[model samples]
Target chain A: MTETPSTGQPPEFPRPTAGPPEPTRPAAGPPETPRPTAGPSQPTRPTAGPPEPSGRSSARPSQPSPRSSGASPAPDSQSSPGPSGRSSARPSLFTPAPGAAPVGRMLLAQTLFEIRLLLRNGEQLLLTAAIPVVLLWLLTAAPVFDTGDYERVDFLVPGILALCVMSTAFTSLAIATAYERRYGALKRLAASPLPRWTLLLAKALTVLVVEALQVVLVGGLGLALGWRPSGSPLAVIVLLVAGTLAFAGLGLLMAGTLRAEATLAAANLVYLLLLVLGGVVIPLSGFPSGVRTVLELTPTGALADGLRSVLADGAGLPWGSVAVLAVWAVAGLAAAARWFRWD
Target chain B: MPPCDTRGMSTAPAVEITSLVKRYDAVTAVDGLSLRVAAGTLTAVLGPNGAGKTTTVEICEGFRRPDAGSVRVLGLDPWRDGAGLRPRVGVMLQEGAGFYPGARPVELLSHLARLHADPLDVPMLVARLGLESVARGRTPLRRLSGGERQRIAFAAALVGRPELVFLDEPTAGLDPQARRATWQLLDELRAAGVTVVLTTHLIDEAERLADQVVIIDAGRVLAEGTPQELTSGVSDDVIRFGGPPRLDVASLRAALPDGSSVKEVAPGSYEVAAVVDPRLLATLTSWCAANDILAEGLQVGHRSLEDVYLELIGAAAERTAP
Candidate 1:
């Protein structure tokens, strides 16, 4: 409990620099020591010995004293290094080797903290998990729209899964990150030993974890609604990973560059547009050929088409759509890294 | 908490700045400011608001770049060697400006601790800062009081066992108890050979805690020395005594030596500014006795750090005014 001494409540510590040791407490009070101001000798450096009374008038006489109170402006405080037990030669008294934790451990710890934050936030849960589930139920069970010759549940599940990835990886991430930037958290981390790249990687991993739960929730809801999925498990996972990377990169770029309020407004707007125009709830076949060609080039459109062809039609690998998403992933991540601002 | 490279640093300053100049748009925030902080001692950059205190410290922390000057922290260029220094230095930005509103104290501290090679125990730090209640709560940081938020920022900064630390206004807006606790922790850190450089607007904070105080105003250093040197250099220690509220000031001025100024600064609080000697002391007391008054609480010390600060700031402002 030697370390416990400093951890005690602060009331015992005197303001003057002289109260360094536990024994100095008695000297800090008024009764034991005579006022230095009362005599000519009082002007001698009050930087040593007992703590002086804290008053504006007495401040000069009571200013920092060497190791008596543990600090002095004498510029030689380093020579003493008086707290005991350790050689003064070592670079740091706090640790034998002062440096950051191994990168993997740091990543793991930060990811856990991020997951806790996401799980606790009602809004984040609704957007990343609940909203997608609600969309699946409404589009299929409600009989709201004609989803083509295929079963309604079958046509909508893959598109809804794509929407789920977009929500978790992009919209939620961008808004959260924007606010973190606005609040000085990014700047604070920038100053810490944790590299900025590690922070970004950790955020991506957290998104992936949440996205997995999302797939389970939305897919489970789809299965209950009489939807039958077709597709290689490996191909489905690869498409999901590519979409997450693309969306996450763009989300982080907006958060690191834009104002939090602006990011909030813009992220929601982009989400709604992608849901309608990217063939999530609306079939891409309904658009004119020229318009469909452009929509197919968008990140959301590429992900939806890839997921739909693989799951709804069992059409196997869709190289063109996968290539589009990979391009977006590389380009989006590079742009984000180049332009991101910490504050 | 001694610096990572202590060799040859016995004489080397922990921080060295020369003619640093920084401007944002048209406003020159720091203009040709130069300073040196000796290793393992606490240096307080004391100034009034807008004195460029934050800007100067920010440059040292490598968060902001100085346009015209060079800054070296622990013998490494702060800008180019920032990553290398991160493990050895801790920085607390002003006012805890962006504590994640959604975070609680323990969660944030634990997260920051994980980023460092070694950190203090989270529970001990929480207890040391008197933040145990908030640490365990699920409440968001934004919902806490300003002082609580400040403590949280402080804990995060210190959790990483850094050899040196830069704290900006560490105790501003803190309640009295919390403020004292912060001061105590700083004292202990210095005792362990950790160097502390902080910026503050409170003159007492500098005088009480700093081994060296740098008084700045309008982006320039007006005075630099120990609190004693700054207060004592203006004159010999002042002669303060207590007597009647309205004693004859005009008559007393005439009785004192040619260079002395006499004033009753407050009711029954008399102060005499002069080259104090046995002769001057006798004359004042004899004069008081003849006037049928007792010089109670007679003391000899110069003015407080506040007076020196105000005098310097006022002069600086006047010189800069059109």
Candidate 2:
């Protein structure tokens, strides 16, 4: 049996002008110009008949023959206006233009879908939200460690919040994205109409939603343990946002550059290491001077110290730590963008 | 060279590449390859493993950039005008491409549909691909069987109603029935004037479906033509018939026309290789009669498309081997 129908020529068939043919006018104009026009025409026609009539009147006087010519050949074109007078009169549908989904709509759908996937994966959820809540409870109840001058519950609350941000923004995000790259999901998306920036934004938005849930659960637990925040809520908000950006950027950098298995191991290792040494559970002041100075500069340490200052000390904002987080965000994101491979 | 006439047809080829060169450090993947596809036809790229077919297709899809070449898809540079060209192009990857393991097929398909401007109806598409049974169940993509996953991926590719489609090993994991269904869908796409470029290992699929078959090996094109064209002149026709064992080949050769030879490839089966014609057949029959022999089940045919493909690949392998 014939695999392909003989009714039409094959796509590889040579055209009349095969070599160095004249450059054709770009096809971009036809598809883009008519989409917005077609979108509004469908909705507007039912509301007001008078507007369509006026539109037809204007279209007829300006470009009547060209419209007919465009529609005549594309009998199967989905957006082509029909031969009937009423349909052709609309002018917008008669243009035979191909439709493209709006960029903003695509981004929104992608972000929602990403969030759903993150929530559905039991492992991802455990890493991003559940683990942090469990850790917050464990660290506060256990009294084997020294409390020093500050209230033990008060100091540990902010550090766990910082840990939550690191888990969602850095470790979980890095592992998931690396696996997506390995599975060819990122390659598939890259081949679609979804712009690169839209994909990045969608992932970022998904991380934010998950982190928001973590904050609520952890904060509620802190409240039950008699931990009261005396700092400005605005300062806490700024620290959370900045911390998320810094960790997410670093996560993407690892996901983009490393293999899936490598990213998995490295992300988990970094999470555990930072949990102990990055001033999350342990105060930076407890360490010796030289080591403390370096540890305080780490992103996790900066985020934890910054949050502790705002939530425990009622310090307005830790501008120095915020500035450090900002630099890491910029450097990590730039590196990820430069070296990331789609497939 | 004239300005594009108002016939409304875009002058740019659906896919065009010139002198494409891609290398991964020391090894070259695609070398000096050039191809042009018209706006409404199906072309199959056939090759053995590591033949660069995937690399070439990825370049057209804008997934991979060629180290040295100019490439365009639907008149736009696939790399530079990717945002503009992608909406009009659909790509079916080799495998499931790591779909969310827990997502139902319908959910993922609908989500993909929302990415396009005017996509095919998701429910209708699911039914068309015979995915209705699996789609209704809330099985995660990874839990589905191989055939089920392939069908879903196929549906995802066509859901956008793209102007051009690139399929990489689309039927690799499908069953016979699903393979037939996939072929029918490809036929429909061709009828709708959508351009298709596929890479496959099945020679019969390429022979039956492809309007043009491009055979590549060692990162280069070995031959390209219609099935009929490729197999036409490669080998002479063979006349085969059952006969008595151990027939004298020297005498038969002297009796037959020049450039003709007879061999008993198998006991009691004789094969005559030459430009088969009425005269040669008559001579062979008369010789059999004179020798008190009977030729049974006479048949004549030329080399098949498969033979040509194998011959070309074998020769190229030898030529390129260290």
Candidate 3:
């Protein structure tokens, strides 16, 4: 029996493109079979309508105008016919059909899906939510550490928030993207009808979504435990957004230039290093004077210091820290744009 | 005519590569290669590992920049206009290429749907790829079988109804059934007038699917022709004279005429690579009759694609061998 409807498109067959050599895209004509699009808000279903026929051998009787421009199926004796029994010509699925207009909306949709996938993963959920809680419990319960004049919760909460942003944007995002490049998902997407920016933006958006979830979970947990932010909630929101964007940029920068293994190693190594150097677990004042100066300018350090100041001392937003974080974000984003590889 | 006007279509070929050279450190991945993929045709690139098939495909996909050489996909430079060109080109990479764990087929396809103006139906795509059984499943992508994940990936690739597609060995690890299904899907795609460029080492896949085959070895083009054309020129009719007796190449060659040549094909047989006209067959039979040489298990047929591929690969290996 034939594989697809008897269309006049060229024969498209399977060829493994990236890794593991499992043939993914079959060379078939564009089977624009008018499927049903999923709902828009659920983040799980497709935006297009659902397709007709679930079985492999449904016979489509309508004979549209056959466009016989490309390579038709060869007259090979071994080539099987389509299910329709009409000349046994199966439509090639790999053939490119025309798409109308630009690819922005498509990109946005992809970004949201990335977010949904990240959210649903158990490991990701633990990293985003449980990790911050565990760190808070560990840091606060330890008797050896001194809290200076402020409450231990006040000093630690802001730092943990900053840490949450960094984990989601940089460490987690790096691993995910690196693996994607390794697996050929990125390469395949590069070949699809999606725009490049859409891919990047989708990734960024996914990070943002997870960050939003982290904020709600961590922030709510902090507030319930009698910890109060000294600064305006609005200012804290700004810090969270900026910090997320900065870390996301850096994450992508690492994912784009390095091999998946390298990205994973470097991302985790840099993340842990920043945690210690940037005063997430320990205050920067405890470090030597020379090292303190260097650490103060890092995005992670600046973010932690600025967040602690606002959340503990009721201080206004720190323009210096904001500028440093913004610069890092822009620089990392530019680098990713220039060098990212999908496969 | 203008730089791109021919028969109301672009005069410049849909894809144009000029002395494409790509290198990694000291290794020359692709060396001064050039090719043309006319719009609306299926072109297959055939090569073994490290033969620069991927490097060439990536250059066309706009994911990697070449060390040297210019590439144009759909009259637009891939490197300079990656975002602009991506919407028109569809790519299906090798299996396990990349997957977001915890993603279902619908979720992934819908996400890609937002990237295009005219995307196919998600359920329809799921059904077409035989992903309906798992459509409602919540398992992460890492849990899906290789074949199932590939189907999801395929759905994602076709979501936008792309104008051009790049398939890098699209069916390497599939079972016979999945491979057949994939082939059918590809046939459906070609009927819609999509231009496809695929790479594979499986000679049979290329032979069955490709209208034109571009054979590559050592980062260069070895030959380019229709599969039939490439196989038809093999001068020798491969004769596998199998019995209880073993033969050597020198003895077999000596047994034939002065112009005839023979080479060992397997342990018990030799292939006579010479023109086998009816007169020669008669003369051979007459000679065998005189010598009491029984030509049992004698078979004659045109060379298959595997023969051509093996010959090309063998020659390349010999040239590269120390």
Q: Tell me, by DockQ, which candidate is best.
A: 1
- Using lDDT as the measure, the top candidate is 1
Q: Judging by TM-score against the true structure, name the best candidate.
A: 1
Where model 1 places Cα greater than 4 Å from the true spot, the runs are A1-97, A287-297, A323-331, B1-9, B239-251, B262-272, B277-300
For residue A288, model 1's alpha carbon misses the true position, in angstroms, by: 5.8
lDDT tens readout by residue for model 1, B1-322: 2432344344888899999999999999898899998877789999988899999998888888889988999898878898898878888888876566688878788888888877888987776566888888888887888888888998887888777899999999988877877876676666556778999887777877787899987788899998778877686446777887887776666666667888788998987887554444545654554455677877655567888898899898898896
Chain A only: list TM-scores of all candidates. Answer: 0.73, 0.71, 0.70
Estimate the TM-score of every prediction: 0.81, 0.79, 0.75
Q: What TM value does model 1 have? A: 0.81
TM-score of candidate 2 against the unseen true structure = 0.79
> Tens digits of per-residue lDDT for model 3 on B1-322?
1111222343446688889999999999999999888665567899999899988998898878888889999989999887678777777766746555556657767766666676776776676666778777776676788877776766676777886788877887878877776776665555455567888898877776676788998889988887767776555444345433454345445444456776656765655665443333333333333333466665444466788888898998998897
Question: What local lDDT score does residue A50 receive in model 1, on the 0 to 100 scale?
Answer: 33
True contacts kept of each: 0.32, 0.23, 0.34
Candidate 2 per-residue lDDT over residues A54-98, each given as its tens digit: 433343232222223332433342222232121222222112223
Worst 10 residues of 3 chain B by lDDT: B1-10
| Model 2: lDDT to the true structure | 0.75
lDDT string for model 1 (A266-295, tens) is 999999999899988888888999999999
DockQ value for model 3: 0.19
